[model samples]
Target chain A: MDLQTLTYIVVGFTFALYIGIAFWARAGTTGEFYAAGRGVHPVANGMATAADWMSAASFISMAGLIAFNGYGASVFLMGWTGGYVLLALLLAPYLRKFGKFTVPEFIGDRYYSRTARIVAVICLILASVTYVIGQMKGIGVAFSRFLETDYDTGLFIGMGIVFIYAVMGGMKGITYTQIAQYCVLIFAYTVPAVFVSLNITGNPIPQMGIGSTMADGSGTFMLDKLDQVVTDLGFKEYTTQVMGSKLNMFVYTLSLMIGTAGLPHVIIRFFTVPKVKDARSSAGWALVFIAILYTTAPAVGSMARLNLMNTIQTGEVGTVEGNIEIANVPQWMLNWEKTGLLQWEDKNGDGRIQYYNDKNAEFVAKAEAWGWKGNEMTKVDRDIMVLANPEIAKLPNWVIALVVAGGLAAALSTAAGLLLAIASSISHDLLKGVFMPDISEKNELMAGRIAMAGAIGLAGYFGLHPPDFAAGTVAIAFGLAASSIFPVLMMGIFYKKMNRAGAIWGMISGIGVTMLYVFQHKGIMFVPGTSFLGDMGPNWFLGISPNAFGAVGALVNFAVATVVSKVTAPPPDHIQHLVEDIRVPKGAGAASDH
Target chain B: MNKTAEQYWKANIRLVSILLVIWFACSFLFGIILVEPLNTIKIGGVGLGFWFAQNGSIYTFLVLIYVYTKRMNALDVEFDVHED
Candidate 1:
């Protein structure tokens, strides 16, 4: 079958499956909408959470980033996984026991102040909006490339798909749909990885592929072999540091951890399990499911890097003497070439693409000796690795079909989760909890749908006009979430002495400082005519990048809250009892209103 | 029940300490700072430290969490702090 027919069957069927799940499991009440009626089994919720957590960024970009960065990118795997430990052990149980509808609801009730709740809402919206913009952009990019539609058409179509499932079915619908998504996405992710792993090493499991000696017959370890190849051509070693950077890597890991914990979509998934124990069990399950994908990503990255370099070097695998004629480049290259992710420009009359390091002065001397004029292959987008992996490995059409289905699974799962989070924050936390305390459940449900539609439209707008940023704009979502919501939720749960005033001020401090730090570094949020920081050495205070500033913001929250709580009054005795109740796992109301 | 609550809390705290220490050791300590020392050892042609840095630690994290939850559930029953 042609690309058009395969794409229609894959993408169309997945979208249909989501709508089918939504109809099968339409949320009847606010509880069902917000927390999946608190009935999801741990394993099911775990699968759903994994789908929710691994967004377009994880599906499309993470492995590609790691492929280029080598060992340093291990931070993403470790930090992201480590976050579940903190969530399960420290946060999830209590939050589930409290059984509030939203994170802000917990803050408002626990701190005994509406002001704190509103501050939390502000933080939640900021983090979530920044995050959702990235997802929308991911959907647009994925759809445009595969469907051969323009970016705007893709964004609108993606918006329609998310709005249908999220508004109609809510969290309850998204949960079952996400479980389906997890299967499709993981299967899509692993098939190509399995193929590439087996091709490069005799190993089928990606874990083994990472360790197995390179197929190079050169007796060097894979990373060591890769290091030699790229370095010989004036590129940085595949396993060693480039730009002499570890400080940024270390801090970036911390930020990713807190950001994972802080993400509203992820946090809301934990609220779906039946009880506090299930919350703990489900978090572990989420991590376990997530690890399957996270662990495989590095293997995919390393193997794909090797494959890419080898392709560029030898042209057709065996022939190292001649160049890869542009017209005759393999089908996968040509396929991705159509997407504008892979391109070639013959700089000299060399009629072939030279993909070696243009930045390497050493490669220039060697290349000139080989009758090459300038570097002809100017750019290769990272998104191509994951998007074009099956094709690049020359896998079956079904496998390529699976990749499209998986990318859609990732994009749609996250989009639904974010949409639900936004809708609930508006309908449950703001409209009902704050403004109309006596609003009927039916009205709130209607409001949830309306709000979700509005949110999807806004997210679609962001997708169409994506802000230029590395790893795309979704990267900043991590920074914003880390600095904002994580601190507030943890403080509310762990610190019983915390008061409303302190919680509000501390969140402001965390969100304010971190946002300023990010705005200073990324001129995306820069004011016109304002000069940003020039040097990493001098500008970032105490050597923390804007990406990692969230951890410091968290520390400030703890310190500020502690000082304020000590000097001021303690929380109401009932609120103290609420904390104790969360721990004992008894007398936790089916849902806490106060 | 008051006695049970105190015992359950104590057990929870104890379990958290053990798990937290292991978590820190595998990730913050072994995976990062002491990675150099452990890199001298290789497992399956992968450096021991690098394996831990990438995959080993994640596997360990899952095991530790499952064990923690299982033990805590048992402790909850032992202390009679479980739900009715």
Candidate 2:
């Protein structure tokens, strides 16, 4: 009946469903472990892929980011979704035709060099491991909020859930569980959005609702009202704010697009489908599923911002009656305040909460005249926007519980996908491909489980003591993948003359330059206080943020590889034939390597 | 490569090029480069450029991928390369 009990029950039921799916789908062979026996229908794989692609960042944090960043956050929406187009058009079907288990394996065979495979494995591990840390933290946050546990305990529990299903089911288990996860997460996400939309505007569709007039017969468009409200409080107009420099937004979007297309976890999902045609169409379906959440996000974001402002600034700005009395603050604020995510201080001993731009010197005189101290809501963390939205809107307890379950599903599905990519690279690419070429299938499967368990442990540890960059490190992961992996994969497929030497050198240079730029700004491995060149705009090259430097790194990679390949001998005839073979859909082998 | 397979590959390349150009125009051009000019024109309570960046480009991307898959499938059939 209560919120806590309801959350535990809903979350418990979802976890039980996942464990059941895992037990039922336990993988029996390497083919099943890595590619789900290549029997997954296109639509099912699409659902799985959507679950795999939308991580905790998308479910929990993206709308929150949009709430504050306004128009600037469009880079994330466009960059992430556009990459699926690249995946479907340029990468997916061809890779499916290649019939490989791991992305590095495709590189290893296509380049006819083990070194290239090893390099690829390294890139995949780096990007995936970094990405998984965010997912682990996301899971920890969801558990901490819902189950009322400490972050460390929540992380440990999350790691255990992944270990049970991922170690036992592998890709086979993960796929079906992800399909379930997609349903849970999408349902949870859209329900509250629909409620919030209807309450704000009469329109039921959040997308159209955001563009329609307010329900109170205000006659002003929602965006028009939102822009007027925020700017009235000295903040930037909601619709007019651009993210950073134009070049940076462009490069950042480009990096995320190619990076999304390049992620090993996402690319491998297409390999589970039965045919090349399935891979192509499955990508379209995946985008359709992802778009459901993506479209709802902006609506949730802008509307949540509108709702949040209306809660605090209950009337016109600069007036004494505008701010809400601290004693009369909504119960949701107190609930989030207990988590230390939302905080306020009465500097001028004013009993009212002022949510406005304190940095606006022009408003300082007005604030002084009104006896206002400053912006009292100092710690309204962006992560709380989505999690606190339902409570803020006075939604029923069951809907709030469903949001908790959905957040966990989004976080866990993505973590499992990344863990699988990491573990398989260790067992199949590193161990069997390199160390023990004659490893039995049974022994390889064992190795895969051990590697997966080990990865979860490492990810959990990082989640507990997340680095300063954890909030934005996902962009870094995308940057690394875009710079290091995507270019080489694209080259291997499109350029027949690209040789082993070129591919290896290209990966090294791409990752190397990207890392150097990032480390110089963010610090090596993102260790705080270790950055030699402080992270400041004036210090950046061409006013490009470290996040946008991936495009430059990718360009350098393409250039270096092309120049190197011209000097070196072309790939052997057999490798050329392999490339030609992948290009055509005929005679595609079953996903099973045998 | 056989003549039919070769032509199919070329057709695929041409199609990708055209689709990708549309992709570039929607997101990079309208959303970023020419956003200021596009913002002069409002669409449905939002700036056209902002709509492109936030909503319109994604719709176009979905349509592009779906169209590519359909056309490529048809081309595969024409070249007698469709999988059984």
Q: Which candidate has the top score in lDDT?
A: 2
Candidate 1, residues A1-594, lDDT tens digits: the string is 977688789878877887888899988877888988888999999999999988888887778877877777777778788889878888888888888778888778888888887787878887777777778767776776787666677678778877767778888988998998999899999888999888777679998888887665756667676777667656776665421246666666677778788888888877888787888899999998899998999889888887777776764322345467766778777666665656788887656677777667877887777766666777687765787777777778887888887987898898888888888888888888899988898999998889888878776776666553224466567777777778777777666677777777778887777777777765545333343764255687767666566777767766776777788877888888777777776655576454
Overall local distance difference test of candidate 1: 0.77
List-wise, what DockQ does each model earn?
A: 0.65, 0.80
Worst 10 residues of 1 chain A by lDDT: A522-531
Q: Which ten residues in a row are the worst by lDDT in model 2 chain A? A: A464-473
**lDDT by residue (tens digit), candidate 1, B1-84:** 277776778778888989989988887677777777787888866777777878988998998889988997888778766666
Q: A214 in model 2: Cα distance from truth in Å?
A: 0.9
Q: Write the per-residue lDDT of candidate 2 for residues A515-560, one digit (tens) a residue.
A: 8998899877767788899988999998888877777888888999
- Model 2 deviation from the true structure expressed as Cα RMSD, one decimal place: 1.6
Task: State in Å the error of residue A212, model 1.
Answer: 0.9
